[model samples]
Target: MEKTTNLQETVHSPKDEGGTTLGLSLDKAWAPKTEEKAETEAGNDSTGDAPEENHDYVTGYKLALLLASVTTFFFLQMLDMSIISTAIPQITSDFHSLPDIGWYSGAYQLTSATLQPLTGRFYTRVRAKWVFLFFFFIFEVGSLICAVSKSSVMFIIGRAVAGLGGSGLQNGGLTVIAGAVPLESRPFYMAFMMAFGQLGLIVGPLIGGVFTQYVTWRWCFYINLPLGGVAGLFLALLHAPDQIKKPQVSFSLLRKVIPQLDLLGFAIFAPCAVMFLLALQFGSSDYPWNSSTVIGLFVGAGVAFPIFLYWEHRQGAEAMIPLSMVRQRYVWVSSIQFASLTTSVFVGGQFFPIYFQSVKGVGPTLSGVYMLPGILSGLLFVLISGSLATKVGYLLPWALFAGAGTAVSAGLISTWGPDTSTAKWVGYQILYGVRGCGLQAGVITLQNVLPPAQGALGIAFLIFCQNISTAVFSVVGNTIFTQSLVKQITALAPSVSPAAALAAGGSAEAVRALAPPGSPELAGVIQAFANSFDTVCYLLIAAASLSFVASWGFGWIDVRKKPEPGKGDV
Candidate 1:
């Protein structure tokens, strides 16, 4: 086998030029001594046929079609993740299930996180198109299951199934892009795909809100059927290529890959994640932080993590997450920033509704409507930053500004009280929209920094970190809000019992029934909700501050770098 030398090349555009020219050169490592090998490989007739040496293959149109196909998959996957937020209240009501409400979301997240890295590796060992097509079908089946689900348990099972498939879409799309395109072109293409993904995030909530209000919440899951089916059919028909390498499914290959699957790590990691999230969900509402359940969860996660780390190290190359990648400074810093950004976003998503409904006296419908500005702004920024990254070759500045803006927005929102003006609240939401631009843009940056060999795995890890952080922070934010609300209500309504006030806070009708007209207890309830909002906002501000520090570590990488001759594959 001839070995190709890998060399890095950089491209620079003249200030006067409107666009940068990235030149790629492919050179044969060794001149062919015979024509028979090339002829056989090319599937040309061998009867007096000569093999073409050093043929340059270009498929601009085919690449475009493949990208479009992958983008559709990406959109559907991300949309499902956030779409349920607006329909949560409705879904819970319809099923008459509250005990496992969180599981509807948490189950999907947990399964996805646990299976992500495995899917990434699976892509390397399987044909990209086949693997994607198989998983796409799985996802569609899951969606259909959810659409017809009559029970909460059935719905959760559907979500779990969907999550298993959704985990593949992100990594699978990237795998296809990596296989189809040259190394230097990836960032630009990645930005394009990310824009679509962000669009799904933006549209998901709005669509869910609309469906829940006007049509039916079931439509939210049903809608994915047509969109996903079209994308999958396109992939199966036009995008599937014969040129891509298929994995050798030998017993030896299975032995190597199966051990690398890290089933033990997943066993430890998944339960820890579930326990931690459960503890977060139940700690303040159902059990105290110091209670046996909460403490045991914390202790279990703490013990499992170090052991998991040691196991990863011991497994070395066979580990699901390689120790070397985890130890990289860029990886850790980027993961922290990504995780923190997600934490802020999730916290905001969870409580902003409460702020609108409880403190600002907006109805659920209106509150969902008010959230549109921030979501739309974030979508716009995702596109802007992605485009900008292609041109500017750096994302740190945008990350820094976004982090600072998020902190400022959170700080401003934290000051809200019963008397706060609606204009100020709307203004705060706009600031949040601006802040979201940075967070979404930062994802492309982190994905760009890792080596191409680890592209899928790296992307999965980034997402995993984000999900874990979001789950944990959501729990913490809830705890903070509940504690602050309780404290404030108790202090203000010394005459009214804490238990009575809590009972009132549980439902709007209960609160109205318990409090007499213009009573001190009613006033106390209002004050308590406001104080809780303020506390959660302050915590978000702190998270944003940490995001700023993490942004600094996003080392600059020039996306315009010229492709070295004969070094097309990364």
Candidate 2:
């Protein structure tokens, strides 16, 4: 039976002395102690650093189970994001809709990027366990829809729904750690979790290739059902410690949900992103950059941008990007670093596989193999960075090293040619990924600076920037790749229409069939693919360079040096 107690979760800014919480649930043994929070807050100093009592880390057997469960889901979530890469060409062939290819990836990112901040807020207000499971179920349902999709439209809808659900997993996972893990030891667990999550990115292509070539393209989505079920079971068994907020429940909590989550601000903000990204899509494809449709979308995004900002300003602390919290130097700067690094990473994600398949003439299965050097190197460094950060008591150096190192690597990558030796390509990937330390740059900095009360929202905002960067830059890369292909094919293979050569049915095997090796058409098409990747890599260089600049903002602050139990530290 539902209790008649008050049910409120008051999320306050860092400057607030202490947060208030109210809930309507049967008294549970593990619920956060309200009295302990007030006592700790009264004893804490001016910097708003969390007291020792506030670091309620779940330890021993529960910690092990929690980490394992989180790792499993992280793998599934990333697998869901990436498995489609190798299978997209076949998927397009089955549905006979080349124009819809962008939607397959874009729709997922759209819902993910736009909706995550509110999900972050939800984490703060409600029971995080329930919220995490809710999104997990949503993700499973979306995957089921995709597996059964018979038309391109159905697949696109499924992708959008999956994006909405999968958006919460990564952010939610990090939020769990920030709340439950002590600051003194947060880096290792955070980094370890992230390192494990990245494993999915490495093997995703191989699994997708095996499924698509040996079975059916639908198996790519089908794999998630079984894996996600296992992860969900594990997540259910563990009682993950969360932020010290009263448990929210009952019909009153339902009534307060809209305002609590800032749905109105999201309504204004989501359209801005949709319209802006649509403009990029339209201008990049058959439509000219100057086309009326593209211009209108751009103008609409422009107008909405200011309106959204103004709305957030009016909403203050509850807004998607809280003005007071983000205004802090460390939070804003780290966000920039995160966006640039994530953009650079995704630029490679979007275009490098194309570099292997189309330019090198490697088949889908082999192309995945070729991308491994980078993924492995990146994964290795994530673990190393985490351990080093924990041991050395500094995070800025790693962030700076990754930022500076990746700029040099991305610059090197932009120079590849169609006949570039295997040695150069593999080395470039290692060079790019050796800077994997960049992955930990943004979130660790955030967890250190924000109060525990703002933990979920801060993480949500940081990832919101990253999701937006990846989504926007993916469209930008597609624009570069498509436009460059059109221009190069026209100039180099004037007799071969770019449309036919770039078609789903016309890729790889068709190119070899229509224009055998040593033929002028084959040479032109391969060179076009080579030149297109080089253009896209320039964007990668720019993004990496910007990340390097943002890295300087991390400064020399020691992440592990928490203040005395009653003292403030900033």
Candidate 3:
């Protein structure tokens, strides 16, 4: 009865100061007329509208629970993404599918990137609680499938499925956070969620290492089940604010909502994304850079991109990329900056462990441990930046800090040699961590600059950029590393077959066994690995430097100040 009352109130509420109630702005065709009728018959105001006020119904203890639920899944999804890096070797060894390794991470990222903006529409049109819950379950099912996979094909399929769900988790969390909190206090909460959420990135490799070494690699996927269940349970029990809106489900409503999903734009963009990523994944690795297959994929992506843009323009508000929103300076700039930053991070996530294993000759567990200095330092700055943003009311400083820090640290890492000291490597990582993590603060600035209606879509678009860039660059990083290593191995260790070194699947253990430990040939092989890593680090520096340049465009906005009635956009 109470649930029914809340729904009725939300259904009839006037647009609040933020534009609309978080979950309550469903189209008339999608809302339940019967509920409104019943509330009217019960002597409630037939208007059924919530009171006009700025009070946040989702505050106090409920908000805490909400944060916990959303952040938990956020952490788990990130952990799931990063953990697979360390376990890739075991997965390949078990399936004997070294050539297919790119697809494992690529599949997840592809689906996640493609589905992200669409999920934003889902949140806006439907109840965010159900949407979040649905995606969380999908993520769990994907994890289950991954855990039970017997072949590379099945595992990649599972990863793509998980990515589909994981796409919603972060965006959904941010969307919910946006709706539930007041504008002034949002930076702290956003920072808090992101800081702890990044702990997954830190612990991911560590946990993956332990599971891969002592237990089965499958445990990496299995671990999500219990944690996700807890998050799902909380979401199920907690309710959106009474003023929050939700879409009503029916066949007629489905017809309206389906088109609003802009499937045509997605159809165009999905192929574009797939083709481009496939080209990168295959070029100079699976196929010659000049191969017909590689050229065809690139050509297809290039052709499809303009068509996708045209389609999105036609769709207008229904579009995934929404040109209306994209035209805004802040939206596009933030998207590009976020894309570059995350691209570098994801590339680093994959290759850092490779450097530890192949170049430094450390095992998976130790490699994860070695990443802590950077991860911990990054987390500390994320927190500090968030707190400072909330207090100072500006966000550009954080972006500049992150961008400059990332560029410097990544540039330093490019100098790493086969025999670089532990102190140097650790120091470089700390430099990257301190500023790299400050990007979280930028989220507050971006979201704060837009009205609530636009903010959700903006956040989704930002996430889409991040994921798509990560997917594309991961392939680029792999291609560079593989090509460089093969070339260097041929030059440095002429007697060691380059193909054999490549086939060893980049396992330090397997590569070390090629010649006696401490022999000149073994040293050459290690040096080749280090030199290849240097190439990837240079790539990171370039991406990070671009991100720094992009940061300069975000005009300093005091996020804590409430925008005047008509001043949301820059």
Count of residue pairs whose backbone atoms collide, per candidate: 0, 1, 3
How much is the lDDT of residue 497 in candidate 3?
82
- Score each candidate by Cα lDDT: 0.65, 0.74, 0.76
Name the best candidate (by lDDT).
3
Look at candidate 2 and give me any clashing residue pairs.
Answer: 8-22
Off by over 4 Å in 3: 1-55, 96-99, 242-244, 247-255, 563-570
Query: Which regions of candidate 2 deviate over 4 angstroms?
Result: 1-55, 96-99, 248-251, 505-507, 561-570
The alpha-carbon lDDT assigned to residue 84 of candidate 3 equals 85
lDDT of 2 by residue, 358-458 (tens): 67776667777887888899999999998888677666678888888788888888899888888998998898886788788778877765555666777
TM-score of each: 0.78, 0.87, 0.87
Model 1, poorest ten-residue lDDT window?
A: 22-31
Deviation from native of the Cα of residue 332 in model 1, angstroms: 1.5
Judging by lDDT, tell me the better candidate of 1 and 2: 2
Ranking by TM-score: 2, 3, 1
Q: How accurate is candidate 2 locally (lDDT)?
A: 0.74
- What is candidate 1's lDDT per residue for 407-486, written digit by digit as tens? 88889988988898878877887787655555544445434444334445566677777666665665567667667766
